[model samples]
Target: MITQSGPSPDGYDPRADRDLPPASGRGDPHRVPEHFPGVSHHEPIGLRRRLALNRMGTFDWDLDRGFMDLDPGALEVFDLRPDEYDGAPMSLVCRVPPEEGIRLDAALSQALQAGTSSYGAYFRVRCRDGTPRWTHSQGRILHDADGLPYRIIGIVREASGELADSALLHSLQKERQRQTVMVQQVTVALSRALSVADVTRVLTGIGGARRFGADGLLLGLTAGGRFEVIAVAGMGGDVPEEMLTSQLDDTLPLSEAAVSRRPSFLGSRGELLARYPRLRPYGEVLPTGSSSFLPLIAQDTVIGALGLFTTEPAVQSTEARNLALALAGVVAQSLQRATLFDQERELATGLQATMLPRRLPEICGGEVTVRYHPASVGRDIGGDWYDVIALPQGRTGLVVGDVQGHDTHAAAVMGQLRIALRAYAAEGHSPETVLVRASRFLAELDTERFATCTYVQADLKSGALQVARAGHLGPLVRDGARHVDWPEVRGGLPLGLADAFGHDHFPETQLFLEPGSTLLLCTDGLVEQPGRDISAGIDALSAAFGAGPEKLEELADRLSAHLWAEPGSEDDMALLLLHRPAGSGAATTPRLRLHVHQADPSGTAEVRSALRRTLDQWRAGEVTHDVEVAASELIANALTHTESGALVSVELLPDTPRRIRLEVEDRSSSWPRRRSPGETATSGRGLLLVEALADRWGAEPRGSGKALWCEFVVPEMPEASARVR
Candidate 1:
């Protein structure tokens, strides 16, 4: 057998006959090839009953799998001959009971799936002495690329004596006492072990750390409810060095017990083998002793499972098993809390997304595209929010705000402030008045938090925009010639800090559509970077917009991609953009004979209705009927499915001598895929219709979301192009 290059565990002595990794494949020349000196040494019960498995068993299974010959008398115990043995299957040499095989198979499968090193179970096998011996068989699985298991080696020891001996139970009753001492030792030593690496080394029995087994100890929570392992004194392999670091979570078996609030027995290795029958091929895969699974229950909850595992067929005495369970319990409690916290965070994220607008409103005067990209990091849902509020007074309320915290509580406050902004705005209040009331609403939020916001109310008639900023980033405006930034209202504080602070009236700033101008409103995530000036981010945005409508989409995508980091950024982001055709001048003073005003909302729903209204007013019959629903669905979809902090714009390209074109702009670069016909899964299918209806339709990234556009030729009016511009 081929042994590894590393030195064997302490006290292991190697000789020329010892098998190493890449063994010669020839049968081992040493008599009774085992981890010991010779057959005679292991034969005498009083001489060397311990397998010296802890000292380092056959290290090179690749070189050879040694099956030492038992005395001829021992072979008579089972009806087997040496000639019948095959290296491919140890089962061919050992007689394992049917139940034992099934049990062990199941265990191996669980171990492999869970990324655990060891899996063991108790089972009965036909012994060479014509006796049925119950034993625990445990194996360690080695994996390679593609996650396939290459080899599994296990140890088996007779457990029948322990199962039947009442006297042995008494002797083992004090196991828990030892476990208690170990827990105290591990806790006090915990401060000394800082990093994950340190923790790993300590778990491996270094620095006075307790050892459940001198051989292969799985230092994890017992499934029943304890922080311990199945103690095997004379076993095999170095105290595993990777278990601490390899674990995804510390709870393990304790979580199981905590959930059930009951003690658990490790399923038999025979059961494990039975479930993973293929593992049987690795060794005379059978059970050695019954194992126990303890749940680590904490605060009335199961955080993980702890396993007292072994390769012995007979169940250990209740006392020993309980000791294992108890030790595992302590470790489990801490791990469970951590896992529960992570779950809560995920739930918070879901709720935050739901709170944001799922769909944007549809407008007819011009096409408006919107995209929102959320930040890549944070513990829970963030405090950023955006809204499309259609006021009763003909103006559209575009608002975006950021609460001061990044948790579920922050999210709740955001929702409250959001509705209040709309309620006051819908009640005929101007953007400045709405901000004043919204500030008051936030001040009573029950928590000391601040909120910053930018509110804009765009009037369609004069193409005039009213903007109010409350301690938020300046607005970016691109008016044909160059990009311009609107400064803050001078003296304003983040909301909720003081009553008088919110009482200050925000000065409203108004600017005309300014011919080919574009307005960009976004959260600070768009401009803030650690150790970098805000101008750097602002410069990036300006440069992309300055490139004009031709490169606008591509540049937007590139910029958005740059914002995401590997370890991720700290805050949630919100970006909203409104672009009017630069030279063509959307909603600008008449310039084209037929001007098609792009009036669509940031979302897909309202955009479609607005598109249909425009087509109907122009008297395009089937053209309007055919794509009304399609346009609505596609445009609404553009609002969702991608990052929320996206730059979205829409354009109305009048077919100069013929048709009117409708274009939606966004930064998402992924090609829209079609799901199975009529998938109700809430994300696909919209793109399918866009492909079929529009003339020469395709997508390119806008500032953030990808623009999905289509063209429709109108025939009725000779001046149709003239009517659109």
Candidate 2:
């Protein structure tokens, strides 16, 4: 039997063990073995105190002696040991029930000898009625100075209760695990914060105090002493939207908890009522059971508190509290991070705009439009730039280029490259030559970035064009000999990839002008990007071009709209074009006839009047004086130089400034040259002055001495004015 050594206190009692028979020689055989399980280090514990312990007890070893002093129930169920195992160590004697053959004393003795002071063991032991049961016995071995085991005092407990408890504990643990995984998934989703309400709702519904899960809250207390919820999650049901949105009294329980910043539990019904008298009415009115309030503390001060509620009182488990606290921390961090990121993005967007073009300059020969979109705000804008330069020869140079990335540096490089290209082209270099030099210049800049470009040179005179593609889109040539002839790739390379790329550039290829022909040049960004293959983009352009060039501006707008159709087409782009007129420059100058006959001055005057009337009818009367003078001079030369044959010729042209210029010729080898001021006779002066007044005068041998001619400006001069006589 287990025992304590001292006299018993109130509510405690002693027990006697009389299992063994009287010994033959030891103490008249009255003392049998006794067990003192779980004894403290002292002289020894008597039997009285052991009986008072709720978790401790002794059992019968032999059936005979235990029945005398025990109650009938105890007697019927157990038998005391009278003679077995006298004075044995408690570790061995206590396990006499549900017996296993692995002698407890022997095993414990072995363990003690090995310097093991305390040990726990599991084994089957015999019960009082001889039933077998699994028992777990534990004990501490007392050692003497020589390091040998002197006594083992311990307790033996039935393992059944503990085993069942273990199963319950395992189930609880699994539930906690599932809850934890769900919380994590929701936390991840909420972290994205695509929308404030959505993110908050998702997180709160999953784990916030606002829903039926663990929840945390942040609130601002009003002048009153009641707590008002600001943000909430994990609580069962809504926070009475009014209660959450309205200001609460500072002295209220939740607010007080927040202000004090102390962690408190409100599980019992009485505790809930005492903490919040207002809640008493709520409970009476609604029949609620369990809740836990955790203060939202920052810098040692409560700013808010987390409240969790459940239908059962078990809602206040440790897991709930832990999750609530963690959720509170996450909300605070997310708030701070999102605010900072938004501010930073705004600043970046402003900076990007400063580097982009604001407006496009008006240029002649074709319309111009420019659009610059910074690479999605908060990111850098790429090095794409476009410039339309009016060249000296009445030609236009269209340039577009892209540097490597989207950043302030790339944008700066783009500006510099644009200026450089314009300067080069203005110096009279062909488009190909300009690209070659630009490439070499870009390569040597050492920016550790590459660039691509396409330059188009338009010849206003012949309406001719030359294109150079530097790792850029080939210029789209539509409605020429071939309706869709891309810029010829005779030889070109991108700028900046290497050093030797630009110096010895190939000669620019020439293309003949066709009526309604158009040439389009652009950066790679225009034709090559995601959401569509380069070929598809090219085809799209071809289709647009084939639709006729009248809708060019509309086409550009359509292109921009198409780009946004697929977000992946987020590359910088630009378009440039050169259009040719319907009539070719090489078309024969307009022909008409101008005749001078050997007639009277009145006849000449009559002819002049007729010419003036006809020219005036055609809106070309400005040429009447020059035509009259040249005709008079030609007729005078022909009449003076030869006998009687007269001729009149007229031609029209479409060139600028001199839209119409003409030559008067007669069969005379003697060309008209300006005579000396004094030597100029009347007839000689006529042709001489004609030679001087006309832009150009000449003579050719027309199966005769020569054909003399004098040129005169037509009525339709593009820029210069004509003087008629």
Candidate 3:
């Protein structure tokens, strides 16, 4: 054996090494050498054999001397010869990469300082051949009798394959987490979308473009068997107008995607050009590198298609495609719901319009105008209506009502209630009696809906108004100075609720309208809003009413504009305004005038012929036959009842709706009573016949002579004819 002197490259003295007992045998290295402290002298041969079979490298370290003894396998792992690296632990430490060498030194130091039994560290080491390998080193530390560290025996193994597998698994898990979060966020947003436009804005917005790496997006929907561009994003003014407005045929890619109900990809400009050569001339309008068309399918039906364009072809990945497909499914479902709602809303609105009054009746002292606004949210159809009914004796019935709920059922119920109210009022019922009968009728129908209504019957000649309310807002009255005031009116329960609770009495409040006063009747929607009390809306309405344009139509427009300036209201509004003009008498120049003697039955015929000619001249020939029959009845009654001959007068009242007024006067001071005639009685039906033929008819005492008068609402004349006379 050779005796090395001094430090031997690891600062180990050869004199100290010689102090330990010699090895048992060269072939049996398993026999613990005296210098290796942690090894047993009688160690099992199986442990040493197993380590050698698996090709694990082993080393022994002297803690006090700072020296290492490497086995032949250990030296082979470092790619060094036994002569070059044997007993040189410093050289072995130098072979490790700098950072890993420091880590290994720290582990050994910790084990020695703490007097621990084991130490382990994993790090990269560079072999003498300049190859890097990941390694895990584990060792056991032994102490001397004085409790000072003496030696360490350890084994090292390669761990490169295990680390690579762990790293791949971690990356895959992170990507899965990210995808799950994205899908959840998109699902929540799509659920809240209320309309097709709302869905389109969310789909092509910022979040969508970033996730799919799309430069532009286009949405096409199938309508009437043709593809139409419903929405677009990121396409600037460069896109042609034809692409937006014109319908697409089956040959187009969008139509193909919808027909096939599958996603299709256009990989390159050449692919697009090959299929759609017509788009080649507008190259800039097309995507640069790639495009994808996805079918939006819901419940096994294709409703539309989505198109995405990207500048780089490689940006379209499998993950992005799957995400797009999932989003398309969400959009398809939401759009289907929106489309059905829109169709139902339109039908409800049409039915509601038919139920409302086609034209407001023009009264002698007041001008009537109306405006209706549907709800701004959801289906947009609700139960709000206004009407002007011409009652007997030159009185007008003003009505505004709102049925509960904003649905088809509510609208249907509103129509029926309006007709019932008009019929009761036309049959000479008082304001309070009309509402009581209407409530009973509504309850009998069993529609399970309630309604709030306000009805006002105004005597135009006397300016006396009788108002009855059924849980509705009282009318706003504007004075001569345009100061608005809400009159005190006691209200009963809503229509259906009154009969349900055994309460049918609706009290009437009488109001005298001064000349130039304006009466406004409106549904609750006009003065009610979410998050704001109805009182606040009432205040705003009062302010709007005070500031008027003086013209009835313009004032109506102004009221609607001011009330609904801010949108998102979920109620329908109906407003009716009746402005009584300053003067209360007849016009100086009537459209037509006739005078006849009532005694001669032949005079009735003469008066009828003269009335026909005058109505024809006024372009009101539509009411000529009705007016003539009414005149004949009134003149016959005057001749038969009164001893003196009567004066027959026919004058057309100048108003928006032209009126033909027929008055027959006799010296007798008797008023005609509308008697109930039996089915077979022909004589007592004369006054009843006149009432049925005329819009309004009654007998008024004029000084000593009683004037039996009736008014017929004639067709409005053209602008040129109205201006003529």
Query: What is each predicted model's overall lDDT from 0 to 1?
Result: 0.53, 0.53, 0.72
The runs of at least 3 residues in candidate 1 whose Cα sits more than 4 Å from the true structure, single-residue gaps closed, are 1-275, 278-335, 350-355, 367-381, 392-394, 407-409, 440-448, 460-463, 478-491, 496-503, 512-518, 529-533, 540-561, 564-568, 581-725
Model 3: per-residue Cα lDDT over 231-349, one tens digit each: 77765346676665445454667777887666767887678778876667667777677888878777667888988777765545544455566556666788898778777777777
Output the number of the TM-score-best candidate. Answer: 3
TM-score of 2: 0.42
Instruction: Rank the candidate models, highest lDDT first.
Output: 3, 2, 1
Candidate 1 weakest lDDT stretch, 10 residues: 589-598
Tens-place lDDT digits, model 1, residues 1-725: 23345533332322333322221111221123243333464354321123322111222122124332221212222234546543334443358653344345445544554576566765556655556655555566656566655555545554556565676444433442464455566555544543333343555555322344312234343333333332222223333433222233233333334344555564466664564454354324223445555555555455445444455556555335534544554444435544454566567777888888777776424335454555554356778888877776566778878998777888888888887888898787887788878888777767788899988887654456777778887566665555454432322466765365435556565444554566677787766767777787677666765554534445345545565332335567776666555443244431101111233233344334444544543446567755565556555565565443222223343455335445544446766666766545755667776767766676666555566666665455446653442
lDDT of 2: 0.53
- For residue 648, give model 1's deviation from the true position in Å: 31
Q: Give each model's clash number.
A: 148, 54, 0
TM-score of model number 1: 0.38
TM-score of each: 0.38, 0.42, 0.55
Q: Across residues 327-423, which tens digit of lDDT does each residue of candidate 2 receive?
A: 5444445544544555655565566455444555454444445544444322345687777777886777777778888777887777777778888
User: Clashing residue pairs, candidate 3?
Assistant: none
Judge candidate 2 at residue 61 and give its lDDT. Answer: 28
